[model samples]
Target: MRPFAFERAPDLAAAQRVVALSASSRAETVPAMLLAGGTTLLDLMKLDVLRPERVVDINALAGRFGGVAAEPAGLRLGALARMAQVADDAGVRRDYPVIAESLALAASAQLRNMASLGGNVLQRTRCSYFRDVSHAACNKRNPGSGCAALGGCNRQHAVLGTSDHCIATYPGDFAQALVALDAVVEIEGPQGARRLPFAGLHRLPGDRPDEETVLRPGEIIAGFLVPAGPWARRSRYVKVRDRESYAFAAASAAVALDLDGDRVREARIALGGVATIPWRAREAEAALAGQVLDEAGAERAAAAAFREARTHGDNDHKPELGRRTLVRALLEAARMEI
Candidate 1:
């Protein structure tokens, strides 16, 4: 919308240098953004929500970081890998159905083809207030101003991991799968390379709702590492929405189960669409371990997932909806022939 300079980065080092220069000099109010797929960044820019003075196009670096590898150790997904490529990979579909399903069920076919895995996880909230510049009270768009969703139309906002400062939900489905699988995010920055737990990448909308991820100023996501586990083969992602197509989730669950003759040996649960972040339900997993995988156990686990959920007036039904979604996903995953 506004005038901005753009350059195609030949490599990661060049991209990092551009970001460093932008940070050192306060020439732009917003930090220089690295453009991969441009699915999220471009959309926000069009909405006038993000106004970076410069954008570093990183597609040139994809040749070096876009490969997807399936190894005996685990799965390694390059951050630059397209969603469609990862979703349709035979190895991913076979061993990590939840990951594939999450990517496939996201946005649409066109978006999946263009969106990168790294950018997908970093997608911003789809809250109307945050997208519409007319709404001057969005805490995420304008920090310390106010959260319009707090007492306004909040039926689509978060019920879990919410705070008085903000209630906007993390809208991406893939991040939920990553959280459930205990994926590690590889990041590179001016300092050096580092790996972070995928679950720890996103921050709660605590007092600073504007500050979302734990990424440093110039950090770029290199890839994601998912450890191979017995449950990975029996995982699935279930989403509930207002429509069958192109609709954001109102409630969703990523469930991975390992059963030992009708008894649960291990379970991993992560909730989306009803939380402020990619929410891992460790309490729910604890409830399912050693328990028989049945309707009663599923319900118990679902209850544990939403045990601390607090909702506003309009979204008061989310906790119940989230529980039902989790229950259904667990049952579906349990029935899978793994």
Candidate 2:
């Protein structure tokens, strides 16, 4: 890792001040970064993909930030709460199966124990071009330089939210669940706290792939709030990866369905591993609403979900695979005992 100064933040305010003071004029570059799990941040730093001048440890504030509360109103998950803790919580497993399943299926037991919910959502792409300094052309790493994955080995790249500049897929399962459940993100910055829709947290790689999330400099993710809904209970997350363990998804779907007998009252679908961001398939949901929760309806919804998918040569099969994954997830969710 590169040489850097470190400090343990005693409180939220102290952490914010350190980052805010070191903030760069560019949104993509922050001189100081807050550390929670250090799962993603440390990895990037060692790879020389991220070179922060200072690292602020925020675990000292975990006493106030790490919490998992489930009430009739909704589910509130603190930013510092470990992935394993939230995934193993009885209320999360029972009431928000999709959320729990996503976390359970991610990384390994050790990573789950260390990774925090806030850091997980903000995790960067696993694109080889971006990670390796040898690859001289990675728009995500060095903006406007070029995108090596655009025509190179791009089977793992995105299809749903591709742009001329970049196609690196967002590689997190939890973000998809949050998007599907319409969770709200609580952000604490130097200005104070504010809430934003989870779906809006990530930005598409339109022309500037370097500018990923909508978070400002010195901003820290405080928590997540998922409202209680009938669809939340009857939800499932299906991930298809190259391997059974410690592998990233090739195509995955998070499905939440609210049904009335055999008919669908509502459907919420968020796609992962095939998009630049946690993709919410509103068109797919529209197709399934008021329709019978059957194979035919699922097929139609799946088609709608990938209608706008644009794939390069190596990843041409992603759209079809994504469609099948969604179909399978919807069918499996329909059969859930909940």
Candidate with top TM-score is 2
Ten-residue region with minimum lDDT total, candidate 1: 22-31
**Candidate 2 off by > 4 Å:** 25-30
lDDT (Cα) of model 2: 0.93
Which regions in candidate 1 have their CA more than 4 angstroms from the true location? 21-31
lDDT of 1 at 6: 88
Which 10 residues in a row give candidate 2 its minimum summed lDDT? Answer: 21-30
Residues 30-120, candidate 2, lDDT per residue (tens digit)?
5788889999999998988888888989999888788999999999999999999999999999999999999999999999999999999
Instruction: List model 1 lDDT by residue over 1-338, tens digit each.
Output: 87789888998889887666655533214657788989999998888888888898999988877979999989999999999999999999999999999999999999999999999998999999999999999878787889999989989999889999999999999999999999999999989999989999999999888878888867788999999999999999999999998889999999998899889999999999999999999999999999999999999999999999999999999999999999999999999997
TM-score between candidate 2 and the true structure: 0.97
Q: For model 2, which pairs clash? A: none
> What lDDT score belongs to each candidate, Candidate 1 first?
0.91, 0.93
Q: What are the models' TM-scores?
A: 0.97, 0.97
Clashing pairs in 1: none
